[model samples]
Target chain A: MRPQHLLHQPLTTQKCTLGCPILDRCLGGAIPCNSITELVAESGSGKTQLCLQLSLSSQLPASHGGLSASSLYLHTEFPFPFRRLHQLSTNFRSSHPCNDHDPCDNIFVQGVHTVDQLLDIMPRIESFIKNSKSRLPIRLIVIDSIAALFRSDFENTPGDLKKRSSLFFKISGKLKAMAMGFGLAVVVTNQVVDLVAPDEGINGLKVGNLGCLYSSGRRVCPALGLAWANCVNSRLFLAKDDEFVHQDNQLVNGDGGDFVSRRTRRWIHVVFAPHLPKLSCEFEITRKGIFGVER
Target chain B: MEISRLPISASQRGKLISAGYTSLSSLSSVSSSALASDLRISESEAVEILKVASRGSRLGWSDGTNSVINGAQNAWDMLHEEESLTCITTSCADLDNILGGGINCKEVMEIGGVPGIGKTQLGIQLAVNVQIPREFGGLGGKAIYIDTEGSFMVERALQIAEACVEDMSEYSRFLRNDVQACQVKIQPKDILENIFYFRICSYTEQIALINYLEKFMSEHKDVKLVIVDSITFHFRQDFDDMALRTRVLGGISLKLMKLAKEFSLAVVLLNQVTTKYTDGSFQLTLALGDSWSHSCTNRVILYWNGDERYAYIDKSPSLQSASAPYSVTSRGIRNSAPRKYCSDHQSNV
Candidate 1:
């Protein structure tokens, strides 16, 4: 029998490179692997677009700190925007390349809606690994908006949030395991909800309301509450401010007339990460997607 | 001496480390090849190391080694479980008073209202408040917002951010750490895909999210709060099949109940109300019916009367049902104590 001092079964740290040149710097070389990371913000704040960019970005070679692997892109609310992804892929390839000639055949994108169905496909991810002939690594995974599946699959019954959240935890656990087992980086995009105070209390008491009213009145539904946050190693919130616009004053997809207001300066906040400090910086969603703007 | 007997290889060690099994506790939990596959190493080498390294100590396979390994891993798991609890403070003095100073950590809560009644506003407010620290009852943690409705207002979140900043202090480092509010307008398939991808964390994280509020309670100790704003948006549009809705709702409820007690968090859900006909008069009823009612600890309904905001507590675990007046000002959700003005005043309560 061998001595016990040398077995390091799990390596908790893996760094993955985000696709965009702008974001790669902000992420501090690469995104931490084997942990749950969040990229959030308001709609049109560039959550989906940023995720798409990363899905393509992870395909770069490891020499540049990229994942050099394929990704499982999960879509919740919208269909997979393959056209946009293709366009962005070509753009990224033409913009930067290690060999200039090396093809980005490494990244693979997949979309699903219901949490259950998503879980069902998880086992197949291993097959994807084997099919790559050990050449293309499955290094990064992305989930664009996990809430849509809970909303669509579960009826908006009084207690569905509880049910949906429970199901979500189960599914999220599987994804985390797969990512860890495959040495992949996981990136999940989530929807944002408003939390106002409750109106029923006396003395102007405001109650914080979770936004799953369809599943109202079932014990406590912490759907994606503390549990979701606890599972992942990092969390990021994306926001946009007026600064996202350029001097040319070009019209961005999500940004229109709102660019001039004091509130229009969109900012993406790095809420949680291992090596990252908590910072909120200005950014913009252009014709392509979310990009960090220089002050 | 025993090192000579082990068949482990450098390649196998590399694979194990890449798979996040750096500690003996992590290794004891999985198959030898599982680590090998994750790290792209040979499984036989991984098993050989496991056999010899686990000597007679509690970490060993046959001797006391397994117990030691299991105990250490279990302890670590507990540490993580204790850490998973999330806490958020509701910036309201009176509301906080009822909720033991603020929204409890690690639990899920709901808020419901009419279209313009500020359900989303409350959610955004809490998401901002959770970023605050312990002196204020928050875990100084970040918020993970999943926006199903198209209206995940960053402007509103920023508005709340500004509010938090107005009351910021030097002692609290939470404000410096920006809380993340992810606005995901998930299409049908996107939601499912996200959940599958979400499950890739350690078991502790899954349990933590499951019994969210309880986990928050333990971590922050005083932290206790979770807010799901308007749970109806996704379901109202989808689930054409009623039976599927019930099945899914039941599943969701079980998870939430577990999340609430295990985490000791205050969960607030924002529920929607639809019109129901009673005799000749039409009345409004909360959506989600018994399924929602059974899962929540408390339920509040919000309705608008001109500019006046009114709310009724329909369900409560301990407190009695009560109705109160309120106003949705630019400052956010404000609770107002109903006063008796005149004998002729028609009371909606």
Candidate 2:
């Protein structure tokens, strides 16, 4: 193919929207097709919540900023959050009344336990995406928390490190190939690790300023480190913050004094992306679904 | 070492093993011209085989020894890099002054304090402030937050980020003459987005993550700060093997120090305070023992002085032992309010 022809090639890659307009705008028109997007956060930072919401949103029509396709949710964190999924589906059903069939039926949920199991299911997942009987083709794949599988499986030895990193490449490489080959949006959730300082005692090692990033008043960095960081095309960080919002209710209610309430505020950050700038926006998870909070 | 260990073709390995050269050391001493005739190979092929053998041999590797002298840098270049090193402001001018213009890049700084003394707040502030554009006298770099104790609050980070944005806009208003200075394109959300957060559960995972940071920082070259909140949390708990913990911690610290220097990024290690029995009395000291103290290039202790919080420069290679009062408000770390003025106002009221 000529170099100029490459530029003129029609952009056939579609986007699977997060169902939130503000977030879609922040993400430069939702999650792009043919790439891996990583959702990194702590346990309660709503990584699963967003994934569950995506599973339903991807089923929406193309006019609504969705791929108008089915989804495959490869969940490592169980028991699958089915109750939450049901609630989100109900909300999804109410929002888009045009679809006759249930949106939940289109989402294929699979439980992945080990790295081997995840790798074993790759070919099956590809075949499923390729030759599905349903009208809605599988255009989205969600791996809820990729870090859990490798967290305790590997030892911290030189040999194990090599194996673990190679596996990381293998898994991500397959996922990327499948994504690009099938025009699927692969979203994987990853855990975080505490960033520590390098010691000065070790010989032949340079010591320098050690800094950290914080979320919810705690220091944290994405889990799995550099090997995994390189695998994903984009990384989105979800963080929650707890603050005491004092309300002066004394004037409104004659007897009531100042009321202090602790509120948990959630935020989503675009750590790095090929198309979007490094940005963040406040988001809240509600019964309706996960939506970006207007600034 | 066996001849099979040499990275060569299987046919060459078979020929070498079939001949007298069963071990890598035997081939290491053989001349390429002599080996070429004996092995029935070309002179260039023999040279290649011998080169691989020497590299595989234990004592025949002299390339590394020669390269060490070649890699040696003069003190002048070191001084130049040091002079150009930028700092991530703590947002507290007094604290930044004591810190020699905030927490400097290319150094591992240990900030230890009692719980609720705002160690995490300062960490979040640095994470937010580090993203300030270079035009505003900031590094305009990203951050890597490794949360061990699960104390990182995103809400607190947003609050700080908002304050940083407000401060930058205020700064831009002051410098309206300069076109670039007038345009503050960064937002609070962008500041939050630039910070990469990691949560570590165990000391082993922490070590693994630290080992992984060298490569991580290489790929994310724009990252200029790495913060580990309370580096002592996992080490201090369930660690009966003191020697092993020390060695592991030493390795991790060394890796972090290397990352800071290599990436020109600042690493801030938050530590907890422990009571030490010394001089017939128990006094508060930074946790992870005395040997761990030498791991950092600088150490600052946050303490409460009556009603105010004070950060004391406990130990540093270049900085003097100085104390500065700073407070962690809802907005983030800032200069402590004048206590005398507050007291007089209260008395008048």
| Candidate that would win on TM-score | 2
Interface-residue RMSD per candidate?
Answer: 16.5, 17.1
Q: Write the per-residue lDDT of candidate 1 for residues B323-349, one digit (tens) a residue.
A: 556544455555653445321333431
Model 1 chain B weakest 10-residue run by lDDT: B191-200
Candidate 2 off by > 4 Å: A1-295, B1-68, B178-181, B344-349
DockQ winner among the candidates? 1
The count of backbone overlaps in candidate 2 is 54
Q: What does candidate 1's lDDT look like per residue over A1-295, in tens digits? A: 1111111322124467655556667766546765567665556667777777776667667766667776667676656777777777677777675435333355565668567678788778767765666456677777777656654566644366445544554565565556656766778776555434433222122112212221112112223443244334466665443433433334554444344434355655555443454354567666656567665
Q: Give the per-residue Cα lDDT of candidate 1 at A105.
A: 57
True contacts kept of each: 0.05, 0.00
Task: State the lDDT of candidate 2 residue by residue for A122-212, as single tens digits.
Answer: 9998888889998799999999889999998999765576577667767776776677667788999999876454322111111011123
Alpha-carbon error at B20 in model 1, in Å?
72
